[model samples]
Target chain A: MNPLIEFQGFNKFFGQHQVLADIDLKVQAGEVVVILGPSGCGKSTLLRCLNGLEEAQGGSLRLDGQELLGPDTDWRQVRQRVGMVFQSYHLFGHMSVIDNLLLGPLKVQKRERREAQAQAEALLARVGLLDKRDAFPRQLSGGQQQRIAIVRSLCMNPQVMLFDEVTAALDPEMVKEVLQVIQGLAREGMTLLIVTHEMAFARAVADRIVFMEAGRILEQNHPERFFTQPQSARAQQFLEKFSFVESLPKTLHKELS
Target chain B: MSFDTAFMLSTLPAFFKAVGVTLQVGVIAIVTSLLVALLNATILVLRTPYLWRLVKGYVELARNTPLLIQLFFVYFALPSLGLKVSGFAAAIITLTFMGGAYLTEVLRAGVEAVPRAQLESGRSIGLSEGQLLRHVILPQAGILSLPALFANFVFLLKETTVVSAVAVPEILYTTKNYIALYYKTYEMLAVLTLLCVLIFLPLSLLLRYLERRLQHGQFGH
Candidate 1:
C-alpha cells in the first residue's frame, strides 16, 4: 500500500541557513512515527513542513498521493486533514472547553452544531474531561488544558495527527495524563507523527524510531533495536544523556525551545 | 456686562438642542470608524497582499494630518473637485476617516497582542482567515482593546468640534453662531466648556460600566 504521507528530497531554509536538507520519509496508514533528536535538530521543523506550517523551499511532499508543495496548494483544506497539538496546549483562553473543541468542526468544516457538539462531548469524555466541558481554559490545570487541546484537534477528525513535543510544557505529574491520551490514540491505530524528547515514551510508543541530527535523518529502525543497539554514534551519545537522572527544574529546560 | 448670566442661561437651551446634532454625528462616526478600523486591522494582521500596503498608507496619511484639514478637504476641497458633499456627510466622513485610522492602530495592537500560538493552533485545524478572525482573533482583540477603544470613542466625540468648520450646525456650531450674533464670546465659551463637561461626564461613566460588563461577560471574572 502507498504511504499515507510521503516526503522526497524535501528541503527547507531560513535565509541562508538550510534547516531541512533533502529529507525523505514516509509513514504508512496507522503508523506511529516518533522523531528523536537533540534540541534544534530540525525534528519539529520536519513535522511542521508536513502540516504546511513551514514552507519547504524545494522537493515534493505528498499526503495521500496529493502534492502539497506549491502555491496552488489549499493549505486550509490540507490542514483539515492533518491535526497538530502544540507543546504549550494553546487553547483559546476566552472560550469554554467545548467551544475550543467545536470551533474547527462547526466554523471551519461547517458541520452541524448538534453533531459537532456530540463529537466534542464524547471526545472530552474519552479524555476524562467531560466535566470540564463548560469550564474556561484558565480554570483548568495545565494537564487538563492539554487534553482539551488534543480533543480540539481530534474533533476535526484529521487523517494524521502531529504532536510537537506536546508534553514538554507539562509538569512531571501532568505529563503522564497527556501521554496516556496519545497512547490511547496509538492503541486505536491512529496515524501519528510525533516530535518529542520523552525518551521512554519514544521507546514504548513508537513503531519505528526516526533519529535525526543536524537537519538530516541520521537513521531509523525498530524502537527495540534502536534502544538496545543504536545504529549511529550520535544516537548512542543522544540516548546516554537520558540515562542520567534529570535534576534541573523543568522551568530551566523550558527555555530550550 | 456683568457676565450676562441671563443670556448664557437662555442659550443653554440652544446648546441642549444642538447636543442632539453633535450626538448624531458622534454615534454615526463611532460606528463607521469601528467598522473601518476592524477591516484595516484585519488586513494588516492577515498580511492581505497589496491591500495591507494601501491600508498602511491610508493610516499614515490620516494619522499624521489634522482632523480639521481632513474635514476641510472633504467639505471644501472635494466640492472644488465637483463632489459636493453635504455638511453632515462631510463631518461623518472626515471624522470617521481620522477616527478609523487611530482606532485601526489601537485594534491592530490588540490583535497582535494575542499570543502567536493561538493563531498557529487555529490554523492547525483548517480555520480560514475569517474563521480564525471571528472565533480566535477578534474576541481576544476586542477585550484587549476595550479600554483603548472607549478612550478613542471619547476622542472621536470631542473631535466633532472640528466639524463646525464644515457648517455642520452641531453643538459648537450653534454656540459659535450665537457668539457671533450676540458678541458674548466669554460667556458662550464658558457655556461651551460646561456643555462639553456635561455631555462627557455621563458618557464616560456609561462607557466605564460597559467596559466592565463586557470584560466580566467575556472572562467571567
Candidate 2:
C-alpha cells in the first residue's frame, strides 16, 4: 500500500534550540504507528506539524500527495482530512458535547444540523458517551472528556487520526477505558499515528513502533521484535529503564517467538 | 417655614417634564456610546500598526482630560471649526466619545480573555474570519463585556449632569432653574439626588444579577 503521509528531512526549531532534526517517516493507510520518546523529544511538535498547527522550519511534509510547506498549501483542507486529539482535550467550553462533535462536520462539511446531530449521536455511542450529549466538557470526567474528544474527531470522518498523549491527564483507572476505545479504532483499520507512553497499549495496538530521542528516530520495528530484541543500544537501554517495562506474558512471548 | 403640600404638588408637572429629557439623553447617549465603544475596541484588537497607534492616542487623550472640558470643546470649539451641532447633539456626541474611551479598554480585556483553543477550534472547523468573529468571538466577548458596559452606562448617566453646563436643559439644568426661581435649594437638590439614586440603583443591581446569570450559564455549558 502507498504511504498516506510522508515527512522527509523534517527540521523544526524554536529560536536557537533545534527540536526535531533531519527526520524522515512514512505511514500507510490503515496502519497504526506509535511513537515513543523521552519528554521534550519533539514528539508532540512532530504531530502538530502534520496537522499544520505548527509550521516547520524546514522539511518536505505531505499528506495524501499534497505538500504542506508552501504558503499556497490549503491548510484548512489538510486539517479536515487529518483529525487530531490533544492531550488537554480542548473542547470548546461553551458548547455541549453533541455540539462539539457536530461543529466540524456542520461547518466544514456543511452537513445539516439534524444530519450532523445523528452522526454525532452515532459517534458518541461508539465511544460509549451517547448519554452525555447535552453535558459540557467541565461537567465530564477527564476520561469522559477525552472520549468525547475522540468522538468529536471521529465525527469529522477523517482519513487519518493523530493521538497526542491523549490519556496523560487521565487518572490511572480511567486510562484503560480510553486505551480500549483506541484499541477498538485500531481494530477497525483506522490510519492512526499515536504518541503515547502507555507501553501495554502501544504493544497491543501499534503495528510498527518508532523510538525517538534528541529530535531523531533511533529505531523502527514491529512491536514484537522491538520489545523483545531491540537492536539499537538506545532502544535496549530505554526499555530497561522505562518504569512499566516488564517482559510480556510467557504465552505472548511464545507467540512472538 | 411652613411645610406646604400645595407648593410640592405644583412642582410635580415640571419635575416630570425634566425627567423625560433626562431619560431621553440617558438612553441616546448609552446606545451611541455602546456602538462607538464596540467599533473602537475592534480597531484596537485588530492592531493594524498605524491605526492601532492612532486609536491608542485618541483613547489616552479622551480618558486623561476632563469630561466637562471635552464637552465644552465639543460644544464650543467645533462651531469655530465650522461644524455646527445642536446643544443636545453635541452633548450626546461628547458623552459617547468620552464613555467610549473607557469602554474600549473593558471590551479589549473581554476580547483578550477568549481562550486560544476557541479560535483554533473555529479555524479547524473552517470558519471564515467574519463568521468566527460574529458567531464565536463577539458573542463570548459581549457576554464578558456586559458588566463593564453597564458600569460605563452608569458613569455616563452621572456625567450627563455636565451637559447642564452647556445649557442642554437636562434634569440638573431644569433643577437649577427651579432653584433660582423658587428659592427651594435644599428640598429640590435633595429630591433630584433621590431621583438619580432611584433610577440608577435598581438598574445597577439588575445588571449585576444579569452578569452573574450569564457567567454561570456560560460555565454550565
Candidate 3:
C-alpha cells in the first residue's frame, strides 16, 4: 500500500540553525510509528511539520499524495486530517471538558450544537471521562486532561494522530492510564505517529520504530529487531542508556538470553 | 463651614441626578475602552506591522501623559483648530482612550499567558484564525486577565472624576457647584463621599467575589 504520509528530504531551519536536515521518513496507513530520540534531536519538530505547525524550508512533504509544502497549500485544510497532543495537555483551560471536545466540531465543522454535544458525550464516555463533562480542565488530573485532549482531537475525526511526548508531564502513576488509552486507539486501527521516551510503551505499540538523532533518522526497524539489534551505533548507544528492566519486551529478553 | 441641613436636603436630588451622568460616562467609556483594548491587543499579538506600531505608540502616549492634559487637549485645545468637542464628549473620549491603553497591557498579558501550545492545538484541529481567536485564545485570555480587568474597571470608574476639570456636570462637578452656591463645604463633601462610597464599594466587593470564584475554578457565572 502507498504510504499515507511521506517526508522526502525535508529540511527545517531556525535562523541558520538546522532543526531538521534532509529527513526522509514514511508512515503507512493504520500503522503505528514511534520516533525515539535524544532530546533536541528534532523528533517533535518532525511531528509539528506534518501538521504544518512548523514549516519545512526544503524538500517535498506529502499527506495522502497531496503536496503539503508549497505556497498553494492551505495549512488550515492540511491540519484537518492531522491531530496532535502536546506534553502539557493543552486543553482549553477555561472550557469544560465537554466544551473543549465540542469546540472543533461546532466551530470548525459548523455542526449543529446538539450533534456536536452528542459526539462529545460519546467520546467522553469512551474515555471514561463522562463525569467530567461539566468540569473545567484545571479541575482534572494531568492524566484525565491528557485523555480529554486526546478525545478532543478525536472529535475532529482526524485521519492520523500525532502525539508529542504526551505523557512526559504526567506523574509515573498517571502514565499507565494514558498509555492504555493510546493503546486502545492503536488497536482501533487509527494511524499514529508518536514521539516518546517510554520504551516499553513504544515497543508494545509501535509496528515500526524509527530512531532519530541530530535532525536525521539514524535507524528504523520492527520493534523486536530495533530493541534486540539496533543497526546503528547511535541507536545502540541510545538503547544502552535505558536499563534492561523487567518491562523490556519478551522478544528482546529472549534475544538477549 | 458648619453643616447646612436645608441646603444639603435641597441639592440631594441634583446630586442624585448627576449620578446618572457619571455612570453613563463610566459605562460607555468602559465598553468602548474594552473593545479598543481587545482590538489593539489582537493586532499587537498577531504582529500586524504598521498597525501594531501605531497602537503601541497610542498606548505609550496615553499611559505616559496625565489624563487631565489629555482631557484639556480634547476639550480646550481642539477649539483653536475649529474642532469643537463638548465637555461630555471630551470626557468620554479621553477616558476611553486612556483606559484602552491600560486595558491593552492587561489584555496583552492575558493573551500571552495562554501558552503557545493552546493555539497550536486550536490550529491542529483545523480552526481558522478567527475561530482560534474567538474560541480558544480570547476566552482563556479573558479568564487569565479577569482579576486585573476587574480592578481596572473600578479604577476607570473612579477616573471619571477627573472629568470635572472640563466642566462636565458629573457627581464631582455637581458637588463643586453645590459648594459654590451653598458654601457648606463639610455637608456637601459628606454627600459626595456618601455617594461615592455607595456606588463603588458594593460593586467592587461584588466583583472581588466574582474574581475569587473565577480563581477557584467556579466558572458557573
Q: Which of the numbered candidates is closest to the native, going by highest TM-score?
A: 2
Report fnat for all candidates as fractions from 0 to 1. 0.78, 0.31, 0.70
Q: What is the lDDT, from 0 to 100, of the residue A112 in candidate 1?
A: 100
Query: What is the per-residue lDDT of model 1 for residues A24-128, given as tens digits with 9 covering 90 to 100?
Result: 999999999999999999999998888888989999999999999988999999998999999898999888888888889988899999999999999999999
| Tens digits of per-residue lDDT for model 2, B79-114 | 999998888998899888888788888899889988
Evaluated on CA atoms against the true complex, candidate 2 attains a DockQ of 0.29
Which order, best to worst by DockQ?
A: 1, 3, 2
Clashes of each: 0, 0, 0
Docking verdict class for candidate 3:
acceptable
Q: Which CAPRI level is candidate 1? A: medium
User: Given the true complex, what DockQ would model 1 score?
Assistant: 0.69
- Report clash pairs, candidate 2: none
lDDT per residue for candidate 1 within B2-42, as digits (tens), equals: 78999999887778778999999999999999999989988
Candidate lDDT values, in order: 0.92, 0.85, 0.90
Please, what are the lDDT tens digits per residue for candidate 3 over residues B113-175?
A: 988888888898889989988888887788899989999999999999999998999999999
What is the per-residue lDDT of model 3 for residues A175-255, given as tens digits with 9 covering 90 to 100?
998999999999999999999999989999999999999898988899999999999999998888786564476663345
List residue ranges in candidate 1 displaced over 4 A. Answer: A62-77, A245-257, B1-8, B35-54, B72-90, B165-168, B173-190
lDDT top scorer: 1
Candidate 3, residue A94: how far the Cα is off, in Å: 2.3
lDDT of 2 by residue, A1-257 (tens): 66899999999998999999999999999999999988998888899888877889998998887788988988787877888888878887777887778877877788889888888898888888889989978899999999998888888788999999999999999998899999999999999999998887899999999989999999999999998998899889888777444644445434444
